[model samples]
Target: MSALFPALLTASNKQALRFDGRALTYAELAATAGSLAERIEGAGRVAVWATPTLETAVGVVAALLAGVPAVPLNPRTGERELAHILKDSTPTAILAAPTDQLPPALAELTRIEVVVAGAADPTPERTLPQTDPESPALIVYTSGTTGPPKGAVLPRRAIATTLDALADVWGWTADDVLVHALPLFHVHGLILGILGPLRRGGTVRHLGKFSVDGVTRELSSGATMLFGVPTMYHRIAESLDTDRELTKALAGARLLVSGSAALPVHDHRRITAATGRAVIERYGMTETLMNTSVRVDGDPRPGTVGVPLPGVELRLADDSDGIGEIQVRGPNLFSGYLNRPDATAAAFTEDGWFRTGDMASLDADGYVRIVGRKATDLIKSGGYKIGAGEIENALLDHPGVREAAVTGEPDADLGERVVAWVVPTDRQSPPSEEELANHVAAQLAPHKRPRTVHYLDTLPRNDMGKIMKRALKSA
Candidate 1:
């Protein structure tokens, strides 16, 4: 198989990456990562202290060059979760920037400082290690909503196939430059945002921390694309009415993509109305890197995740009322959960389709509208199945509603009752429960209206901006 980043193997001087104002050309990155690779070439696996920094990016690239699997450890992870990941992956060494204070759990591992300043080799002559397509390249851990986080072993082929498919669908080219402020631990930020640009020999500028001003500056200065999650897009939508520079910057960009969680229809309308740039959405999970995305040349359907990517098979299992659990099989899928053969076997069907616990309905044009998760988003009340996502969107349409999340509670009459958790735009003058319920009932069906409403200052969310519904249920 060829090198994952072919441009790195060359001596081109084009800028490949920029983080926190520090820029690196392809020639510099190749030499730096090559030098680092030689230090850990024989390791079985390495752990990268995944921070939004240049060193983290160089470290992961170095591990790939050495044909060693890299495990990205989230910096904000809880102590127990971090301990579990280290125990599970059993990495022989850990890589971090010199300035990072080592956590007690990672203190015992062999530490390697990734320094990018003086490692550049203008002319490099070392032969990069050849790795098989099926070899593991990354070990990304899931959010572990059910139990301890499970490591999803992604292979070189999965990464290559996904990026290539996205290039074809997005019309991505080497001339493009991407701007984003997404976290580096998740696949959305690391694989799609960072690695995707590298594979195309393009440039990526990371925002260190996401801010509307930072996004405006980069997009206004010739960035071709923007990748973000729903939370970030929500913030952008809120600022578009007040920030003229942001509106102009987004309008000038060639593409805007949202993922990790579904972007609300309300936010989609706000952004598109202000900037004339409809934000396209994609659907995938830890097990499957990417399955479906809205095409660049096709309709930017506001609420749907377009169709399946090239060379992927998708199906709906246990259909009812035109909605069912999504199942997929593709080269973009991870090899399996690391060291958990029984769990891995259970994740797949007898025919080899990976069972994604998300539920969605397919449109006539093969567009996928994700309702919610099969476990948390599906609600059954009065013998009618309802998706929390649609109701939440409807709630957001109200002028007084700022944020909303829906869940089901036990009901003596209706097997389960729809419950709403809301954050009002004006805390002192929040919308009444009856008024909000009526608003939702008018938009959707009467049966889908919330039976109980609870007010909150904010909804719980994870690093990727996904609403933590389980936390709401527990609360």
Candidate 2:
């Protein structure tokens, strides 16, 4: 197999990565990561303490260069969750910065301090070992909504195919400078945000932590792209009207992408109205690196995640009403759950398509609009298969709503009745249940109106800014 990053070998003095205030040229990165790779060459598997710092990036790149599968452990993970991951993966060694204080869970494993400045006065033309494309590159764990988090083994082929597909769609090239401040444990932040730029031989500037000032500083300088989750974009939208600098910075960006959760239609309109730049939405799971994206050349549809990516085949299961579970078949899909053969076999259909539990619909133009998860967002009220996303969108369009989430409850007559949880813009004068119900009924069918409304100060959200509907339902 060819080298994953050919540019690393044909090294130049060009800047490859910038994290916080430190910068690394391609030459320096090649030398540093290459030397680190030599130290951990034969490890069965390695764990990277995935901090949003330069050392974490170097450690991951080193693991890749050594052809060892890397398991990225989140720093803020709970002790129980961390224990589960370490026990499940059973990595031979754990990699971290010299200054990092590891937890008790990792005390039993071998420690490898990843020093960024190890290769001093290093030369170019560094060598990287080649590995089979189908070999595991990274073992990323899922959110563990149902049970213990499962590690998804992603292959080098999946990474290459997914990044190349994104490049084709986004017009990504060496000239592009990417900017982001996202966690390193997930696919959206690490693989797409970090490795995507490296594959293009482009520059990546990591902000360490996301802030409006940091985003403005990078984009205003020379960064051409900004990658963020819906929460980050929401903050940007809130500040755009007052911060002329932020509006100008966002307007100047060549691309603004959102994923990991749905960007509310209200936020989308506000950002676009403020900066004259629309945010592109993409859809994927940890099991699938990326499936669909609103292309750079395509229409910027607010609700849709555009069409299937290059070399990907997507289908909707049981599409009687044009809404169904999204199933996909592509090289970009993960190999399987690390140790759970039963779960691995169950993830895919006999025909080979990976059954994504999320639900969505297809537009006439082949655009994909995600509705909600099958377990939480699809409410069967009065024998009607209603999607909570449309109702949430309608509720958000009203002036009083700040944040909204929808779920269903058992009903004697309706089988399930739609229930709404909202964070009103004005808590003192929150929209009455009748007004909100009528507001949704006006935009959609009367049957879709919420049978009950619960007002909250704020919606429960995960780290990625996705509303925890299950939590809301339980509450």
- Minimal lDDT window, size 10, model 1: 117-126
For model 2, the local distance difference test gives 0.92
RMSD of each: 1.1, 1.3
Clashes of each: 0, 0
Clashing pairs in 2: none
Residues 1-475 of candidate 1: C-alpha lDDT, one tens digit per residue: 1378988877588889999899899888888888889999989999999999999999998998899999999998989999999999999999999998878999889999999964467568887678999999999999887699999999999999999999999999999999999999989999998899999999999999999999999999989999999999999999998899999999999999999998988899999999989999998887899999999999988878999999999999988888899999989999999999998999999999999999899999899999999999999899888989889989999999999999999899999999999999999999999999899999899999999999999999989998999899988
TM-score of candidate 2 relative to the true fold: 0.98
What's the lDDT for candidate 1?
Answer: 0.92
Sequence-dependent TM-score of model 1: 0.98
lDDT of 1 at 62: 92
TM-score of each: 0.98, 0.98
Error of 1 at 138 (Å): 0.3
Top lDDT: which candidate number?
1
lDDT of each: 0.92, 0.92
Name model 2 segments beyond 4 Å from true.
Answer: 118-121, 124-127
